[model samples]
Target: MLRAPGVYRPRADTRLLVEAIREAALPRGAHVLDVGTGTGVLAVAAARSGAAEVTAVDVSRRAVLTAYLNTRMRRLPVRVERGDVQDPSETRQFDVILSNPPYVPSEQPRPPERGGARSWDAGSDGRAVLDPLCVRSARLLAPRGTLLIVHSALCGVERTLTRLRRSGLKASVVARRAERFGPVLRARAGLLEARGIIEPGQRHEQLVVIRGDRPEPLEGPEACGDGT
Candidate 1:
């Protein structure tokens, strides 16, 4: 139950991510961070999954408030903070990081600074937020930490995997689901088709959850290697 007008509502993508989280086999008392948390759905789910410390961050103030309120109402110990994943200020690392960020491609070169559009509109190629998040994941995760991010396949799932891997994390697609176009995507169907981002008459998009894991540190000689 979100009271904020601009906060994104939990939909198919959210449900998919939650299901993946439940199947992640998170260790008890694991620390989790939810980026772009709207209404704290994923954060609450993390708590229910036995995460000892759950923190949620979002760029929108209203979204932060809504998430905090929802978590409180559910009696979940989730700390909701207002922050942007693209330019995060928090320095704490976590065992798991979760996100269902804006992935919709828009005509504008960049997302809106305010209003409802901020919740779903990504840049022209839909990599505005996704790219940055992938780059930062390695730094945000603790040893053997995992990152689970959900987005439309139209936004380039392969690109995400490549980026995360280049950042020194093992990445792969763990889950996927095809969903019919919603009001937002439906309205941009023609433009997306024109841009060759979608089929001429495509009415659905595949949502994928990419999982990236930071490898555990090597011990003994590997840890104290000479310059090689």
Candidate 2:
């Protein structure tokens, strides 16, 4: 059953995350972190993919409980926790971190049908969760590790990339899908911009999967030039 705020239900996007992580070709036995482990979909996938250890976290206690149950059902090796993405105690460090954060920007009052906390909302621009996730990722990811984020293109992909770069991480677009919001799409960016969240002239509807890799000095320009 799908949950409120568009998170509870399992969707194709979750499967996409699993496929993308597998495509990255991470070594077996590597420690993995599944941020916002929602229904433990990615966590279970990682465990099945041969991760040595998988730690899953969600800010919602209910989600955490759900993840734990799901992990038990699959009999996967996963440690589930309840905490915010920015919490330092979430874990020491990880070899791989994956997250499908709440991607909708909060441009206006949430609908009566919507319960704010059940969904990922970052003020007027939807970066509330993502911005902090990026910062924490910089600290949590091990050297040469990878962090994958799936988000809607309507939220400002370029700006997301820029933030990742400023956070001492290299960001790039990994995947995208074109979706229509019809007449509602026209006012999306404006609603956010009116609140000074988005700058003028930003277009919506372009979900993307972004990848950020931990830096390795040996792989730097000097090493590349050394050619040895």
Candidate 3:
């Protein structure tokens, strides 16, 4: 397993996203981008699944380095970069984009600027990253591209679906797993309950994988452009 300070470790949510990626049936040599690739687990999985190219992005330098080292150890040709998915600079659209961003609701309006909390503490509504990610995913995907994102249901699953659908993409919940709250969620249980996001004494949250697919051009088949 990969190890790094301030980097998110592989967890149930990560596994759920990986399983969803496998079920997506991506075309051979499809270009894949993994946003918030904490340990590059999904990126490595995509490479092993026959992706022609895999690129991973994260806002944390430590996360980028950790992912880079992890992918290298597996001998996977994953390109790891320090960047935010909401403001990605890469012009090429990806055939598949995967993300497991921070979704735990926090009392603060913004995520921490530094510290281990950045790995899981999202804003007050838990949409700080998820919201922008939905907007950017539409632009980052190529025609007929697929986007798979995993987040806690407490963050508003319907909201994510609504946002993606509003962006002209077909979105749905593809997979879900109910898991007991870990350290992060446990710590915020009171606040979440107070905000009525969770039931009193509730100790479990459902993690869902939302899939958004861009429709192919109707004017005739289009060739897959090289993902720059």
Best by lDDT: 1
Once model 2 is optimally superposed onto the true structure by TM-score, how far is the C-alpha of residue 15 displaced, in angstroms? 3.1
Cα deviation of 119 in candidate 1 (Å)? 1.1
For residues 1-228, what per-residue lDDT tens digits would candidate 3 score against the true structure?
777987898999999998988888778899999998988999998998889999999988998899999999988879999888766466779999999999888989999988888888889999998987887787788998999999999999999998887676789999999999998889888999999999999999999999998886511111232111
Candidate 1, run of 10 with poorest lDDT: 219-228
Query: What's the CA error at residue 176 for candidate 3, in Å?
Result: 0.9
- For candidate 2, lDDT tens digit of each residue in 1-228? 223343455544566677788787877998999988888888988898889999998766667878898888878899998876676565587988999887666654431224433445555567767776776787777887888888776567887787666666678988767654434345565675676644577554556788988786423322332211
Query: What are the root-mean-square deviations of the candidates from the true structure over C-alphas?
Result: 3.9, 6.4, 4.3
User: Where does model 2 exceed 4 Å of error?
Assistant: 1-7, 108-117, 180-204, 217-228
Lowest summed lDDT over 10 consecutive residues: which window, candidate 3?
A: 218-227
- Clashes by residue pair, model 3: none
Better of 2 and 3 by lDDT: 3
Tell me the lDDT of model 2 at 134.
Answer: 73
**What's the candidate order when arranged by decreasing lDDT?**
1, 3, 2
Q: What is the lDDT for 24 in model 3?
A: 81
RMSD to the native, candidate 2? Answer: 6.4
